[model samples]
Target: MNTIDKRKLSRPNFNDPIPNMKSPSPLPDATIQQKAKTDAVDVLNARTMAILWKE
Candidate 1:
């Protein structure tokens, strides 16, 4: 049996990989996260208006 050299194996370079990340302007979270944020804002606004109405 002959010994095979391991140094001939090739690998892809990673230094210039294509970016898969999303833009930062509006963030990249899922719609569920966005809905949750909106719901929280609505709840807070409603509570604030209620308190203001009572004052």
Candidate 2:
């Protein structure tokens, strides 16, 4: 049986920022809601079409 030492592991620093990384701008709340609704409607339509085609 082998034993490992926990003190030998190196921890990551979350406070440090990476260079040359760009964050994306988020969409407005209205746009986000509209997109989600559109996606749900699309999924429903696809499911309905699949059932109709199988009949």
Candidate 3:
């Protein structure tokens, strides 16, 4: 089996305990995230408008 299949087979308990590394990482910056969300919303809204215009 592949690594993913092996993991699925023994999901509850694996060969080793889960790690607890607690190094904090900063979240994505607000402007970058806002741009991505805006792009996605624009794409969806354009598709919706196209469908409505067709109907």
Q: Which candidate wins on lDDT?
A: 3
lDDT of 2 by residue, 11-52 (tens): 555577865343344777678779999999999999999999
How well does each candidate superpose onto the true structure, as a TM-score? 0.47, 0.54, 0.47
Native-structure RMSD, model 3: 8.6
TM-score of 3: 0.47
Candidate 2 ranges beyond 4 A from true positions: 1-25
Query: Which sections of candidate 1 miss by over 4 Å?
Result: 1-29
lDDT assessment of candidate 3: 0.77
Q: Residue-wise lDDT of candidate 3 within 1-55, one digit each (tens)?
A: 5999998877775566656533243655576678789999999999999999999
Alpha-carbon local distance difference test for all models: 0.70, 0.73, 0.77
lDDT of 3 at 10: 70
Which tens-of-lDDT digit does each residue in 1-55 have in candidate 1? 1233343334444565656654455644776578888999999999999999999
Q: If both were scored by lDDT, which would come out higher, candidate 1 or candidate 2?
A: 2
- Candidate whose TM-score is highest: 2
Task: Give the distance in Å from residue 14's predicted Cα in candidate 2 to where it truly belongs.
Answer: 26
Candidate 3: which stretches are off by over 4 Å? 1-28
Native-referenced Cα lDDT, model 1: 0.70
